[model samples]
Target: MSSTSIIKVQVDDTQFKSFLDLYQEYQEHLESAPDDWKKVGDAIGDAGADMEDFADASKASKEFLLIAATQSEIISREIRKASAANNALLESLTKNVTAQKSFADQAERSEKHMKELKKGASEFAHEIFGLGSFLMRLGALGGSLAGLGGLLSGIGLKDLASSAVDTQRSARGLGMTPGQLTAFNQDFGTRYLDPGVLGSISSAQSSFSGRMWLARAAGENMGQVAGEDPGQLAANLAIRAHNWWVNTPASMRTAEVLQSTGFTQSGFNLNLMKQLGNTPLAELQRAAAQYGSDQGRFNVSDRNTDAWYGFLRQIKDAGNFIETHLTNKLSDLAGPLQHFADAVGKDVTVLIDQIFTPANLNALEDGINGFTKYLGSSQFQQDMKDFAGLVAAVAGAMRKAARFLGIDTSPSSSTNPASIPVNPGLDPDEVQRETRGQVRGYGGVSFADKALGYTRHKLNMPSDPRAVLAEMDAKNGLPAGTLEAMWAKESSEGKNLVGPVLRNGDQAIGDLQFTGAAWKDWGKGGDRWNFMDEAKSGGAYMGFLSKRYQGDIAKALAAYDWGRNVDKTIAQNGANWQKGLPAESMDYIKIAKILNSQKQNVRVTVQNSTAARVAVQIMRPQPNEHFYRLSVSV
Candidate 1:
């Protein structure tokens, strides 16, 4: 069941680019941190000078103060002690200022790193790219992420899935809001999401870049960029992408932009510079489209803006928030500065004598203690470090912009998925499994919805319907058209599956709408997908029931719908089993009679709501076997 669902994330992620811009702004923000910290040290020094001035003036007035005050020696000793501690506090402040400057300088210098992506960004890109590739690989098999894949991603209801953690905590974690990820999955047209997340059926962790992308896609109409105009949207993306490349110099195009697209399928793969790189917008859109039909065709560029400028706008916003946060935190140092200034701003004589008292000495002791703990607390240091690390990460991500941003157009053999996690739930999308290779001209939409839409087509009864019906007729040795009417009633000739993963027991599969339990119990151990297999297997069960019911076709059909337990109803009703039959089952017989010419072709479809299963799949045995097994097992 482990597979992947690719979002077809385009090249030139605007969110990522905006993140690059954030790196620039954050770098500027970090540069001032050292100087900002230096100002704090200077303020403390000025306060210290005020204390020294008071001490000097107090010495000049020492004789007068001795005349005015008792315990003069004690007062003198306290004055010396307080003055010495103030000096020590100033010296400690200077050292801290130097350390802060060093860290800020390093963070600032890291911004100048133009060639290499930092570790954080490298890790982020690895996960996102890995997840995308993982999805593509899983798309080959056809299952789902936690089996929630096709149903949720197909219809934009993936948001309903719970990200409940289980035995193992996830590797790459969820991004921000689950809603945004859901929107991104929908807008991005992804069926499967996340990697290496167990216990979670749908979502995986959102890496830093991924968080910004999902957030941007979810925010303020960003995900709605595909506004009801597919043709125009496709044209707009092509024009804008080409316009951005118009200013590019030959050297950059040759060195950087040439190999940008690589093997990644989505994004602006347009190469204006190359002699043969000219892929027309219409043709390019056509090539990228999943299915050829008008409704089914999906031009990745034409579909959504989560991969382009909208993403960039979000990155800029996030960067602004980070920059403002750092500057605001630094400005808070003014409070301590003002506190010290107020203490030293007092009048000379009264303050000088008061400064020698026990309370004032203790206050001085507090100020000195404040130099280490208040100015250089562990919390503040950690905050600075965290912000600095993030700021440095912005620079790291910027370096990768050149490599992944449509500069490389050549297809590579494979991608490096080492950085991405491997989630066991990664599986094929719901469409592939439900359709089972028979693409009905519908874009990879939900199979159940597809069937419901084709209700009229089923009622008309296409040529293919006769093939399975004839097989059932020949196998069961029953009257012709009996199974045809039944098939039409159940699923309009296999037009729909029960649910995406056959998740509901009431929902069934194949031409017969066989529940997992019924398929296993009566299908005679053949491929459930094959129409002949289902027909023959189903016919034998019907034949057996027909013999048991004394050649009564109506009684046998009822037994098929209500399970073997329907015998209780027949026994209770004695010779008149039809007396106990529900209206829904009675309709089933009447329609079969009409279609097969056992009676008139009155109604086009039959009603058999009593379809039941008495067993379940062995995977995780359910308590109630009568309740039936779900399609998720199938």
Candidate 2:
């Protein structure tokens, strides 16, 4: 620990070089030495033990030990300093490494941006060149047009050209050749002259000349008509002209002919005068006057019958055209068009039937039938059937169409359901009673009269039985004590008869009375049981009574009695009762209730035999002659 102690150490060039090299190397090693600290510490610890083991040696060992101790001390101090320097260098190096990575990432992003810019520039250049090529083609076409001197040779352009320096001015004065004028005239004539219009036109020469001028004007402005062959244009134009003449108004016909022939308004007037000077204005005026007079009164009524006949002829002709010319010509487009034809055919059939009267309807039917046979002979039976059904549907639609047209014939009822007979006046009750008796008799009842009698007797009873019994008397055709007497009879029977017989009798009586009440009330005035009305009103009442008794026997019997009475009444009065109360309506509610209750009761009885047995055993204990609360909780 003394600062005065001289520690001898050997040093030479190699050692000094080693020391200098090692010093620099040590600086580097120190920078990385934190990685090796644990190994360095272990070596230092071993050296201290080696120094102690040599203590047993002589004076020479003592001298060596002193040098070794000083050397160890110096080495240990250097190791500690190197360890601190190495840690500091390592921390600095980590910061430099992170900074380098950040720079590299920024460089990569800049490189990617440059690549996208280059791609965009390449596309912009390509579009510019493509536009340049299109402009060059247009420029070349213009130059070629300017060089066409041969085509303009016949026009005496040099003389006119001096007077009109501009090319447009010179071209405007040019005239068409005789052939061209004639071709123009023919084209306009065909276009404007439909058969009907041609038939009406006066001053034929003027009409023809006007048409010629109009065609020339149209050709000059619109180019030759599109979609027409050069050779066929003349023929097509002639047909078109004929159609125009047929359809055009008298005043407008001459003007349309002039316009189609290419004449200006002034030119048309001059040409018309030249063409028709010999025809006399009075004759033309007379013809026009006749046409004008017919305008409002114009009707095809005189020819309507013939027109319809002709219409049928036209339909047949068109159908034939479709099957022959069109089908063959447009074989590829035929499938869908054929389907359309079938639809149109069906619609046509319907139109005919609707427009025609019943007397005339048979003609339409015959036409349709004939068409069907035609279709059947071809490969379109399915198509025909579909068309026929559609036509049948439209038969009614034609009535609406006829109405719109102001035709006043009766609407055809070919497809309507058969009409029912009208009922004359008759007693509904008698009719219903007779009908009921018949139904009962059919069901093996021997006494039809007895059945009717029983039904009638039950019908007269009041709905509130207690009220009825309370008010009963000989005056009302019942004994004063009749109910009391009946009650006594019932009690006696209850004691003597088995449970089943008593219950059955009670059920039969209740059912009979319920049905009789329903039937009697069905047609009675003032809230009486109209079977139809009761059907709607009685739903809740029926449900309540069914749930109250925990059974539907009373409801079923009520329905049966109603059904029987209605049937008897219908048979007795026939058509008369049919008008009053429909026999079907009478039976409807009753039958439905009976069947529904039967199913429900059968299921209930099967599922709960005990309930069924109890119901059968207990006689529904006769409802008291006087109204009393009968409480039973389910």
Candidate 3:
């Protein structure tokens, strides 16, 4: 471009380019604007064209403004609708969260209830077993009150079964012969309901039920098998197998054990029996492996022989027992039998798929709820009160008979073995005669008084020395009655009472008979061998032994008898700790175990029909080492 003319042309070109840029910017704005705004812009442009064509420009522009206002209102309405939809969604989400929390709370409460029910069931089972045994024993002894059986029946164990099974059904299931069923009803019914056996069954049930609840709570399968309380079935089978084995001739039993392990010890035999009694599934399997195929015991091919006939008879007897007690035509008793079995066995889990099926759990829940209501009822409490009064009446009648016979059943009457009532009543026939003989005999009182005074003072023990020992047991974590029995063996209540002096002439002294050497180190001082000193030192030593031997009571007691340096004594004694002990020491532990187990408790009172108080005395039997007895009135 030229200088003057070219400069003018260039400036015009630059202005044209700026105009093009503004046009491009306007087009871009039109493309990006809202559809409604574009419509408004188009109407405005049309209004402008109309104004350009017509005379009223103000009216046309007013019309265009009205259109734009209408478009703006539509856009505002749409925004408001979207906002309302979002608010509704937020509200729905909030409600859902609250509902979830409520559901979670309900679940938590359900779990807690289940836990409590399981615990309660276990405790109830234990008490029921104990009470049942007590009542059954009384019945067996011909002293059972009519109401005791009624009380157990009221608990309604029979109502739990709904699988169309009973004793009759069970017999059919087992394919039992009619003769076998008849025989079983006679023999098995008498034996199966024994108090001790019932106690074991109750224990098994508690274990099984507890495991079931625990597994369900953990969201795990309760048992490995279907259709059986595996624990109980195994235990029952094991028990039967053992009983059968044990009943065989001694030689046969010996051969079986030898075949299983090549060598045997008493401990091993005891352990084996215990295993059979406990009857874990694994143990059951092992028993089956060892004994399942043995036809020698069961062989009936030689029917003419006495042994063969006896074996057949025994089999028939056992079959009868099972058919009569555990099986029937109406309902299979297998379920109930298994229930009892599981109660006695260890490591029992509930048969979740079997006993704790949905239907059964529901029934249990209902039963528990109903029982809870019954317990709260006044009539139930009244029945318990009535039962207690009846027991008192029976006890009173017996006591009257005892007193008329002039038997001094008092706590302080005997000292060699403390007189405690084993069962308070007009003593059993044998006991009554013995008590009468003792009364007619001379010098029994004189001997007891002299021994009691010295022994009571020396031990710093109560008139009821056993009670004092029991208290010590609670305070020091010793098993009940262990220390008292130990004392009894050491001093026979401080002087061998009626027996010849049993001292080994080692100058042992005090209730526990600490040797001079041990007394020097532990009994405060050698010369000061007193009851308080002996107890403190002995307890500490026992604690040491417990820690060292991992609470094996037998081993600890053996070491105690062997003297100090228990480890050295154990080393010298080899495997049998009792080998080198003096006869008295050996005898001491043996007697101690028995004496410690002696339980004589009496809770009796006399109240007349007129509600007048009569003589109230509680007596326990004072049993000597030979279980010779004297009665005590407390």
TM-score of each: 0.24, 0.17, 0.21
Tens-digit per-residue lDDT, 505-591, candidate 3: 123445665544455666665222345555666666655655566655555666666544345546897777567554534665584
True-structure RMSD, every candidate: 50.5, 39.4, 41.6
| Cα lDDT of model 1 by residue, 385-422, tens digit | 65665555554444345345533322223333343333
What C-alpha lDDT do the candidate models reach, one value each? 0.49, 0.41, 0.49
Candidate numbers sorted by TM-score from highest down: 1, 3, 2
Whole-model alpha-carbon lDDT for candidate 1: 0.49
Q: List ranges where model 1 is wrong by over 4 Å.
A: 1-464, 499-506, 525-529, 595-634
TM-score of 1: 0.24
Ranked by lDDT, the better of candidates 1 and 2 is 1
Q: Give the TM-score comparing model 2 with the true structure, all chains together.
A: 0.17
Q: Taking the candidates one at a time, how many backbone clashes does each contain? A: 33, 47, 34
